[model samples]
Target: MGLLKNLDPLLTADVLHILRSMGHGDKLLICDCNFPAAEVSTKTTTKKHVIITTSLPPVIDAICSVLPLDYFVEDRVQYMIPDAGLELPPSSVDVKNLFTAAIKKHSDTSLSGVERTSFYKESRKCFAVIQTMERRPYANLILQKGVVGPDGNDLKP
Candidate 1:
Protein backbone atom coordinates (compact mmCIF):
# COMPACT_ATOMS: atom_id res chain seq x y z
CA MET A 1 0.00 0.00 0.00
CA GLY A 2 2.77 2.39 0.82
CA LEU A 3 3.76 3.87 -2.55
CA LEU A 4 2.71 0.71 -4.32
CA LYS A 5 -0.16 2.49 -6.00
CA ASN A 6 2.33 4.70 -7.81
CA LEU A 7 4.05 1.78 -9.51
CA ASP A 8 3.12 -0.44 -12.40
CA PRO A 9 1.11 -3.53 -11.58
CA LEU A 10 3.80 -5.61 -13.23
CA LEU A 11 6.07 -4.24 -10.52
CA THR A 12 4.09 -6.02 -7.84
CA ALA A 13 4.88 -6.15 -4.14
CA ASP A 14 7.10 -9.18 -4.56
CA VAL A 15 8.89 -7.68 -7.52
CA LEU A 16 9.48 -4.44 -5.64
CA HIS A 17 10.76 -6.34 -2.65
CA ILE A 18 13.15 -8.32 -4.81
CA LEU A 19 14.46 -5.18 -6.46
CA ARG A 20 14.84 -3.39 -3.17
CA SER A 21 16.67 -6.29 -1.60
CA MET A 22 19.21 -6.67 -4.37
CA GLY A 23 22.68 -5.30 -3.78
CA HIS A 24 24.99 -3.69 -6.26
CA GLY A 25 26.17 -6.13 -8.95
CA ASP A 26 23.18 -8.41 -8.37
CA LYS A 27 21.72 -9.64 -11.63
CA LEU A 28 18.04 -9.95 -12.60
CA LEU A 29 17.10 -12.15 -15.50
CA ILE A 30 14.31 -11.34 -17.94
CA CYS A 31 13.20 -14.55 -19.58
CA ASP A 32 11.38 -15.02 -22.84
CA CYS A 33 8.30 -17.15 -23.48
CA ASN A 34 10.30 -20.20 -24.50
CA PHE A 35 12.63 -20.05 -21.51
CA PRO A 36 12.16 -22.65 -18.78
CA ALA A 37 11.80 -19.99 -16.11
CA ALA A 38 10.20 -22.14 -13.40
CA GLU A 39 12.80 -24.83 -13.88
CA VAL A 40 15.65 -22.36 -14.06
CA SER A 41 14.48 -20.42 -11.00
CA THR A 42 14.31 -23.63 -9.04
CA LYS A 43 17.79 -24.63 -10.16
CA THR A 44 19.30 -21.23 -9.42
CA THR A 45 21.74 -21.18 -6.56
CA THR A 46 19.67 -18.37 -5.05
CA LYS A 47 16.56 -20.55 -5.35
CA LYS A 48 14.31 -17.68 -6.36
CA HIS A 49 10.66 -17.72 -7.32
CA VAL A 50 10.02 -16.72 -10.93
CA ILE A 51 7.69 -13.75 -11.28
CA ILE A 52 5.90 -13.98 -14.60
CA THR A 53 5.05 -10.50 -15.73
CA THR A 54 2.84 -9.15 -18.51
CA SER A 55 5.19 -8.97 -21.47
CA LEU A 56 8.85 -8.44 -22.22
CA PRO A 57 8.79 -4.76 -23.15
CA PRO A 58 6.47 -3.47 -20.42
CA VAL A 59 8.18 -5.49 -17.73
CA ILE A 60 11.57 -4.34 -18.97
CA ASP A 61 10.42 -0.76 -19.09
CA ALA A 62 8.90 -0.87 -15.62
CA ILE A 63 11.85 -2.60 -13.98
CA CYS A 64 14.48 -0.52 -15.79
CA SER A 65 12.75 2.67 -14.77
CA VAL A 66 13.36 1.95 -11.11
CA LEU A 67 16.43 -0.33 -11.07
CA PRO A 68 19.85 1.10 -11.87
CA LEU A 69 21.90 -0.83 -14.37
CA ASP A 70 25.48 -1.67 -13.34
CA TYR A 71 27.56 1.08 -14.88
CA PHE A 72 30.81 -0.29 -13.45
CA VAL A 73 30.75 -3.30 -15.75
CA GLU A 74 31.58 -3.42 -19.43
CA ASP A 75 28.08 -4.69 -20.00
CA ARG A 76 25.28 -3.66 -17.66
CA VAL A 77 22.69 -5.45 -19.73
CA GLN A 78 23.11 -8.70 -21.66
CA TYR A 79 20.86 -10.48 -24.16
CA MET A 80 21.02 -14.13 -25.07
CA ILE A 81 22.54 -14.87 -28.43
CA PRO A 82 20.77 -17.19 -30.81
CA ASP A 83 22.39 -20.52 -31.51
CA ALA A 84 25.41 -20.44 -33.79
CA GLY A 85 24.47 -19.85 -37.41
CA LEU A 86 20.99 -18.71 -36.36
CA GLU A 87 20.01 -15.05 -36.53
CA LEU A 88 17.95 -13.30 -33.88
CA PRO A 89 14.29 -13.11 -34.68
CA PRO A 90 12.64 -9.83 -35.66
CA SER A 91 10.83 -9.66 -32.33
CA SER A 92 14.09 -10.09 -30.49
CA VAL A 93 15.53 -7.18 -32.42
CA ASP A 94 12.56 -5.05 -31.40
CA VAL A 95 12.89 -6.15 -27.76
CA LYS A 96 16.58 -5.30 -27.86
CA ASN A 97 15.77 -1.84 -29.10
CA LEU A 98 13.21 -1.49 -26.34
CA PHE A 99 15.80 -2.39 -23.72
CA THR A 100 18.32 0.04 -25.22
CA ALA A 101 15.87 2.89 -25.30
CA ALA A 102 14.65 2.18 -21.76
CA ILE A 103 18.17 2.19 -20.29
CA LYS A 104 19.23 5.21 -22.32
CA LYS A 105 16.28 7.01 -20.80
CA HIS A 106 17.96 6.81 -17.40
CA SER A 107 21.67 6.06 -17.99
CA ASP A 108 24.35 5.60 -20.67
CA THR A 109 24.81 1.83 -20.41
CA SER A 110 24.13 -0.48 -23.35
CA LEU A 111 23.29 -4.13 -23.96
CA SER A 112 25.72 -6.95 -24.78
CA GLY A 113 25.02 -10.38 -26.27
CA VAL A 114 26.23 -13.61 -24.68
CA GLU A 115 26.24 -17.17 -25.98
CA ARG A 116 23.15 -19.31 -25.28
CA THR A 117 24.75 -21.67 -22.81
CA SER A 118 26.54 -18.86 -21.05
CA PHE A 119 23.31 -16.93 -20.70
CA TYR A 120 21.54 -19.89 -19.15
CA LYS A 121 24.45 -20.56 -16.85
CA GLU A 122 24.46 -16.94 -15.75
CA SER A 123 20.74 -17.13 -15.12
CA ARG A 124 21.41 -19.78 -12.53
CA LYS A 125 23.43 -17.30 -10.50
CA CYS A 126 20.99 -14.42 -10.75
CA PHE A 127 19.04 -13.10 -7.78
CA ALA A 128 15.80 -13.75 -9.67
CA VAL A 129 14.34 -14.10 -13.14
CA ILE A 130 11.10 -12.52 -14.35
CA GLN A 131 9.45 -14.52 -17.08
CA THR A 132 7.48 -12.63 -19.71
CA MET A 133 4.93 -13.69 -22.26
CA GLU A 134 7.11 -12.58 -25.14
CA ARG A 135 6.87 -15.05 -27.99
CA ARG A 136 10.10 -14.06 -29.63
CA PRO A 137 13.19 -16.21 -29.79
CA TYR A 138 16.36 -14.91 -28.10
CA ALA A 139 14.50 -12.27 -26.14
CA ASN A 140 16.09 -13.14 -22.81
CA LEU A 141 18.19 -10.49 -21.05
CA ILE A 142 19.96 -9.88 -17.74
CA LEU A 143 20.43 -6.55 -15.97
CA GLN A 144 23.03 -6.02 -13.30
CA LYS A 145 22.27 -3.60 -10.47
CA GLY A 146 24.30 -0.41 -10.06
CA VAL A 147 24.67 1.81 -7.06
CA VAL A 148 23.10 5.23 -6.76
CA GLY A 149 25.62 7.99 -6.33
CA PRO A 150 25.33 11.02 -4.04
CA ASP A 151 24.02 13.03 -6.95
CA GLY A 152 21.15 10.48 -7.36
CA ASN A 153 22.71 9.24 -10.59
CA ASP A 154 23.83 5.74 -11.40
CA LEU A 155 27.44 5.51 -10.27
CA LYS A 156 29.63 4.88 -13.28
CA PRO A 157 32.92 3.02 -13.45
Candidate 2:
Protein backbone atom coordinates (compact mmCIF):
# COMPACT_ATOMS: atom_id res chain seq x y z
CA MET A 1 0.00 0.00 0.00
CA GLY A 2 1.18 3.53 -0.83
CA LEU A 3 1.94 5.97 1.94
CA LEU A 4 0.26 8.94 0.37
CA LYS A 5 -3.45 9.14 0.99
CA ASN A 6 -6.02 10.32 -1.58
CA LEU A 7 -3.25 10.56 -4.13
CA ASP A 8 -3.83 9.32 -7.62
CA PRO A 9 -2.28 5.94 -8.27
CA LEU A 10 -0.83 7.25 -11.51
CA LEU A 11 1.33 9.72 -9.57
CA THR A 12 4.22 7.44 -8.89
CA ALA A 13 7.31 8.37 -6.93
CA ASP A 14 9.00 9.83 -10.00
CA VAL A 15 6.01 11.96 -10.85
CA LEU A 16 5.69 13.24 -7.28
CA HIS A 17 9.36 13.98 -7.18
CA ILE A 18 9.13 16.01 -10.35
CA LEU A 19 6.26 18.04 -8.97
CA ARG A 20 7.97 18.56 -5.64
CA SER A 21 11.22 19.58 -7.27
CA MET A 22 9.62 22.34 -9.31
CA GLY A 23 10.12 25.89 -8.05
CA HIS A 24 7.85 28.83 -8.37
CA GLY A 25 7.59 30.01 -11.99
CA ASP A 26 8.63 26.64 -13.33
CA LYS A 27 6.38 25.27 -16.05
CA LEU A 28 4.87 21.81 -16.42
CA LEU A 29 3.27 20.49 -19.57
CA ILE A 30 0.44 18.00 -19.62
CA CYS A 31 -0.03 16.77 -23.14
CA ASP A 32 -1.77 14.25 -25.34
CA CYS A 33 -0.26 11.24 -27.06
CA ASN A 34 0.72 13.14 -30.21
CA PHE A 35 2.55 15.97 -28.41
CA PRO A 36 6.09 14.94 -29.26
CA ALA A 37 6.70 14.65 -25.52
CA ALA A 38 9.91 12.66 -25.80
CA GLU A 39 11.49 15.13 -28.20
CA VAL A 40 10.31 18.12 -26.26
CA SER A 41 11.23 16.63 -22.92
CA THR A 42 14.84 16.44 -23.97
CA LYS A 43 14.97 20.24 -23.72
CA THR A 44 13.26 20.54 -20.33
CA THR A 45 15.02 20.86 -16.98
CA THR A 46 14.15 17.28 -16.03
CA LYS A 47 15.33 15.94 -19.38
CA LYS A 48 12.88 13.07 -19.16
CA HIS A 49 9.46 12.12 -20.43
CA VAL A 50 7.00 11.01 -17.76
CA ILE A 51 4.16 8.96 -19.15
CA ILE A 52 0.84 8.57 -17.35
CA THR A 53 -1.42 5.91 -18.78
CA THR A 54 -4.62 7.89 -18.57
CA SER A 55 -6.74 10.53 -20.27
CA LEU A 56 -6.23 14.30 -20.02
CA PRO A 57 -8.90 15.23 -17.48
CA PRO A 58 -7.82 12.83 -14.77
CA VAL A 59 -4.21 13.69 -15.33
CA ILE A 60 -4.98 17.39 -14.99
CA ASP A 61 -7.00 16.72 -11.87
CA ALA A 62 -4.25 14.70 -10.28
CA ILE A 63 -1.52 17.23 -11.01
CA CYS A 64 -3.57 20.22 -9.97
CA SER A 65 -4.38 18.62 -6.68
CA VAL A 66 -0.80 19.06 -5.52
CA LEU A 67 0.68 21.66 -7.85
CA PRO A 68 -0.22 25.26 -7.24
CA LEU A 69 -0.93 27.63 -10.14
CA ASP A 70 1.14 30.78 -10.52
CA TYR A 71 -0.76 33.85 -9.49
CA PHE A 72 2.04 36.23 -10.41
CA VAL A 73 1.86 35.62 -14.14
CA GLU A 74 -0.94 36.64 -16.39
CA ASP A 75 -0.67 33.42 -18.31
CA ARG A 76 -0.51 30.92 -15.50
CA VAL A 77 -2.48 28.36 -17.45
CA GLN A 78 -2.28 28.00 -21.21
CA TYR A 79 -3.96 25.83 -23.84
CA MET A 80 -3.13 25.22 -27.47
CA ILE A 81 -5.16 26.85 -30.17
CA PRO A 82 -5.34 25.78 -33.77
CA ASP A 83 -2.98 27.63 -36.07
CA ALA A 84 -5.95 28.98 -37.97
CA GLY A 85 -7.18 31.18 -35.09
CA LEU A 86 -7.94 31.48 -31.39
CA GLU A 87 -10.90 29.16 -31.38
CA LEU A 88 -10.10 26.29 -29.01
CA PRO A 89 -10.46 22.77 -30.30
CA PRO A 90 -13.03 20.51 -28.67
CA SER A 91 -10.43 18.75 -26.65
CA SER A 92 -8.91 21.99 -25.50
CA VAL A 93 -12.28 23.12 -24.22
CA ASP A 94 -12.46 20.00 -22.12
CA VAL A 95 -8.98 20.74 -20.89
CA LYS A 96 -9.96 24.28 -19.99
CA ASN A 97 -12.97 23.14 -18.01
CA LEU A 98 -11.05 20.60 -16.01
CA PHE A 99 -8.15 23.01 -15.48
CA THR A 100 -10.44 25.77 -14.27
CA ALA A 101 -12.28 23.45 -11.92
CA ALA A 102 -9.04 22.07 -10.55
CA ILE A 103 -7.53 25.40 -9.63
CA LYS A 104 -10.63 27.44 -8.87
CA LYS A 105 -10.27 27.32 -5.11
CA HIS A 106 -6.57 28.06 -5.25
CA SER A 107 -6.49 30.73 -7.90
CA ASP A 108 -8.66 33.13 -9.80
CA THR A 109 -6.19 33.00 -12.68
CA SER A 110 -7.48 32.88 -16.19
CA LEU A 111 -6.45 30.65 -19.04
CA SER A 112 -4.75 31.89 -22.18
CA GLY A 113 -4.51 30.49 -25.68
CA VAL A 114 -1.27 29.86 -27.50
CA GLU A 115 -1.12 29.15 -31.18
CA ARG A 116 0.16 25.75 -32.27
CA THR A 117 3.65 26.87 -33.20
CA SER A 118 3.94 29.23 -30.24
CA PHE A 119 2.75 26.50 -27.93
CA TYR A 120 5.47 24.21 -29.16
CA LYS A 121 8.07 26.90 -28.74
CA GLU A 122 6.91 27.66 -25.21
CA SER A 123 6.72 23.97 -24.31
CA ARG A 124 10.38 23.47 -25.06
CA LYS A 125 11.16 25.63 -22.03
CA CYS A 126 9.00 23.69 -19.61
CA PHE A 127 10.58 22.16 -16.50
CA ALA A 128 8.90 18.84 -17.24
CA VAL A 129 6.52 17.20 -19.64
CA ILE A 130 3.85 14.68 -18.70
CA GLN A 131 2.38 12.73 -21.57
CA THR A 132 -1.00 11.14 -21.15
CA MET A 133 -2.78 8.50 -23.24
CA GLU A 134 -5.34 11.03 -24.41
CA ARG A 135 -5.76 10.81 -28.17
CA ARG A 136 -7.86 13.93 -28.66
CA PRO A 137 -6.49 16.58 -30.95
CA TYR A 138 -5.09 19.70 -29.21
CA ALA A 139 -5.40 18.13 -25.79
CA ASN A 140 -2.46 19.96 -24.31
CA LEU A 141 -1.89 22.46 -21.49
CA ILE A 142 0.93 24.24 -19.70
CA LEU A 143 0.79 25.10 -16.00
CA GLN A 144 3.07 27.52 -14.19
CA LYS A 145 4.04 26.61 -10.65
CA GLY A 146 3.29 28.95 -7.75
CA VAL A 147 4.41 29.36 -4.19
CA VAL A 148 2.36 27.81 -1.44
CA GLY A 149 2.53 29.90 1.70
CA PRO A 150 2.85 28.55 5.25
CA ASP A 151 -0.90 28.63 5.62
CA GLY A 152 -1.31 26.31 2.63
CA ASN A 153 -2.73 29.02 0.40
CA ASP A 154 -1.07 30.06 -2.81
CA LEU A 155 0.78 33.36 -2.53
CA LYS A 156 -1.07 36.00 -4.49
CA PRO A 157 -0.27 39.53 -5.46
Candidate 3:
Protein backbone atom coordinates (compact mmCIF):
# COMPACT_ATOMS: atom_id res chain seq x y z
CA MET A 1 0.00 0.00 0.00
CA GLY A 2 1.44 3.34 -1.00
CA LEU A 3 0.70 6.58 0.83
CA LEU A 4 0.28 9.77 -1.15
CA LYS A 5 0.27 13.24 0.38
CA ASN A 6 -3.09 14.00 -1.12
CA LEU A 7 -5.48 11.07 -0.69
CA ASP A 8 -8.01 12.19 -3.24
CA PRO A 9 -7.41 9.98 -6.26
CA LEU A 10 -8.63 12.40 -8.91
CA LEU A 11 -6.68 15.35 -7.60
CA THR A 12 -3.65 13.25 -6.87
CA ALA A 13 -3.50 11.73 -10.32
CA ASP A 14 -4.31 14.69 -12.56
CA VAL A 15 -2.22 17.33 -10.84
CA LEU A 16 0.70 14.97 -10.34
CA HIS A 17 0.79 13.82 -13.92
CA ILE A 18 0.53 17.35 -15.26
CA LEU A 19 3.27 18.70 -13.05
CA ARG A 20 5.58 15.83 -13.93
CA SER A 21 5.38 16.65 -17.63
CA MET A 22 6.35 20.25 -17.05
CA GLY A 23 9.84 21.73 -16.90
CA HIS A 24 11.21 25.19 -16.19
CA GLY A 25 9.35 27.97 -18.04
CA ASP A 26 6.26 25.77 -18.26
CA LYS A 27 3.12 27.50 -17.02
CA LEU A 28 0.25 26.24 -14.86
CA LEU A 29 -2.85 28.34 -14.83
CA ILE A 30 -5.08 28.43 -11.77
CA CYS A 31 -8.12 30.39 -12.74
CA ASP A 32 -10.59 32.27 -10.60
CA CYS A 33 -14.23 31.28 -10.27
CA ASN A 34 -15.59 33.00 -13.37
CA PHE A 35 -12.85 32.72 -15.98
CA PRO A 36 -14.95 30.61 -18.40
CA ALA A 37 -12.35 27.87 -18.67
CA ALA A 38 -14.13 25.89 -21.37
CA GLU A 39 -14.36 28.97 -23.56
CA VAL A 40 -10.80 30.20 -23.21
CA SER A 41 -9.35 26.71 -23.69
CA THR A 42 -9.85 27.05 -27.40
CA LYS A 43 -6.84 29.30 -27.71
CA THR A 44 -4.51 27.15 -25.64
CA THR A 45 -1.59 25.15 -27.01
CA THR A 46 -2.28 22.29 -24.62
CA LYS A 47 -4.43 19.29 -23.86
CA LYS A 48 -5.09 19.76 -20.17
CA HIS A 49 -7.72 18.56 -17.76
CA VAL A 50 -8.90 20.88 -15.01
CA ILE A 51 -10.40 20.27 -11.60
CA ILE A 52 -12.80 22.90 -10.36
CA THR A 53 -13.48 23.53 -6.71
CA THR A 54 -15.81 26.01 -5.05
CA SER A 55 -13.42 27.04 -2.30
CA LEU A 56 -9.87 28.32 -2.62
CA PRO A 57 -8.28 26.14 0.02
CA PRO A 58 -8.99 22.84 -1.71
CA VAL A 59 -7.69 24.14 -5.02
CA ILE A 60 -4.60 25.45 -3.31
CA ASP A 61 -4.22 22.29 -1.29
CA ALA A 62 -4.41 20.14 -4.36
CA ILE A 63 -1.88 22.12 -6.38
CA CYS A 64 0.66 22.96 -3.67
CA SER A 65 0.88 19.29 -2.77
CA VAL A 66 1.95 18.34 -6.28
CA LEU A 67 3.83 21.31 -7.76
CA PRO A 68 6.10 24.05 -6.47
CA LEU A 69 5.20 27.48 -7.79
CA ASP A 70 7.72 29.61 -9.66
CA TYR A 71 9.37 32.00 -7.25
CA PHE A 72 11.66 33.81 -9.70
CA VAL A 73 8.64 35.44 -11.33
CA GLU A 74 5.63 36.45 -9.35
CA ASP A 75 2.42 34.57 -10.06
CA ARG A 76 0.67 36.37 -12.90
CA VAL A 77 -2.43 38.11 -11.57
CA GLN A 78 -5.02 39.62 -13.90
CA TYR A 79 -8.46 41.05 -13.44
CA MET A 80 -11.30 39.72 -15.57
CA ILE A 81 -12.17 43.07 -17.09
CA PRO A 82 -10.15 46.21 -16.53
CA ASP A 83 -11.52 49.18 -14.55
CA ALA A 84 -11.90 50.93 -17.90
CA GLY A 85 -14.59 48.41 -18.78
CA LEU A 86 -16.49 46.75 -15.95
CA GLU A 87 -16.99 46.57 -12.22
CA LEU A 88 -14.87 44.31 -10.04
CA PRO A 89 -15.94 40.98 -8.67
CA PRO A 90 -17.22 40.77 -5.14
CA SER A 91 -14.99 37.85 -4.18
CA SER A 92 -11.77 39.10 -5.72
CA VAL A 93 -10.22 39.58 -2.32
CA ASP A 94 -10.90 36.01 -1.28
CA VAL A 95 -9.51 34.77 -4.56
CA LYS A 96 -6.42 36.91 -4.29
CA ASN A 97 -5.90 36.08 -0.65
CA LEU A 98 -6.34 32.39 -1.31
CA PHE A 99 -3.60 32.41 -3.93
CA THR A 100 -1.41 34.42 -1.59
CA ALA A 101 -1.93 31.89 1.18
CA ALA A 102 -1.36 28.94 -1.13
CA ILE A 103 2.04 30.17 -2.30
CA LYS A 104 3.01 31.28 1.17
CA LYS A 105 2.29 27.73 2.28
CA HIS A 106 4.74 26.35 -0.30
CA SER A 107 7.45 28.97 -0.97
CA ASP A 108 8.47 32.63 -1.05
CA THR A 109 5.87 33.94 -3.46
CA SER A 110 4.93 37.23 -5.12
CA LEU A 111 2.54 38.09 -7.93
CA SER A 112 2.87 39.83 -11.30
CA GLY A 113 0.01 41.74 -12.83
CA VAL A 114 -0.73 41.43 -16.53
CA GLU A 115 -3.32 42.93 -18.82
CA ARG A 116 -6.11 40.63 -20.00
CA THR A 117 -4.58 40.14 -23.41
CA SER A 118 -1.17 39.52 -21.93
CA PHE A 119 -2.58 37.04 -19.46
CA TYR A 120 -4.28 35.18 -22.26
CA LYS A 121 -1.03 35.12 -24.18
CA GLU A 122 0.90 33.62 -21.28
CA SER A 123 -1.93 31.20 -20.52
CA ARG A 124 -1.64 29.71 -23.96
CA LYS A 125 1.81 28.49 -23.02
CA CYS A 126 0.65 26.62 -19.93
CA PHE A 127 1.14 22.88 -19.58
CA ALA A 128 -2.31 22.60 -18.05
CA VAL A 129 -5.13 24.65 -16.61
CA ILE A 130 -6.86 23.93 -13.30
CA GLN A 131 -10.16 25.74 -13.02
CA THR A 132 -11.86 26.35 -9.72
CA MET A 133 -15.58 26.96 -9.85
CA GLU A 134 -15.07 29.69 -7.33
CA ARG A 135 -17.86 32.22 -7.30
CA ARG A 136 -15.45 35.11 -7.52
CA PRO A 137 -14.68 36.84 -10.78
CA TYR A 138 -11.31 38.17 -11.87
CA ALA A 139 -9.53 35.50 -9.90
CA ASN A 140 -7.64 34.24 -12.92
CA LEU A 141 -3.93 33.56 -12.27
CA ILE A 142 -0.94 31.79 -13.84
CA LEU A 143 1.91 30.09 -11.93
CA GLN A 144 5.38 29.21 -13.19
CA LYS A 145 7.66 26.58 -11.66
CA GLY A 146 10.97 27.29 -9.96
CA VAL A 147 13.76 24.96 -8.87
CA VAL A 148 13.63 22.85 -5.76
CA GLY A 149 16.58 22.52 -3.40
CA PRO A 150 18.53 19.25 -3.40
CA ASP A 151 16.95 18.22 -0.10
CA GLY A 152 15.04 15.40 -1.85
CA ASN A 153 11.80 16.39 -0.16
CA ASP A 154 9.70 17.92 -2.92
CA LEU A 155 7.19 16.75 -5.54
CA LYS A 156 10.03 15.79 -7.86
CA PRO A 157 12.15 14.25 -5.17
How many residue pairs clash per model? Answer: 0, 0, 0
What lDDT does the true structure give each of the candidates?
0.81, 0.85, 0.63
lDDT tens digits, residue span 4-88, model 3: 6545443655667777778865777778656756666665557675766566556765666556655455443333344455555
lDDT of 1 at 38: 86
Give lDDT tens digits, candidate 2, residues 1-157. 4667788787888889999999999999999999999999999988968999888887887888788888888999998888874676676677667756765644667888888999999999999999999887788899999999778977888
Clash list (residue pairs), candidate 3:
none
Quote the positional error of residue 122 for candidate 3 in Å.
2.0
| Candidate 1 lDDT by residue in tens digits, 29-138 | 88887898888888664667655646687888888878977877897888899767888878778877876686677667667899898899988888887888888778
By summed lDDT, the worst window of 10 consecutive residues in model 2 runs over 99-108
Q: For model 3, what is the error of residue 119's alpha carbon versus the real structure, in angstroms, after optimal superposition?
A: 1.6
Better of 2 and 3 by lDDT: 2
Error of 2 at 27 (Å): 0.4
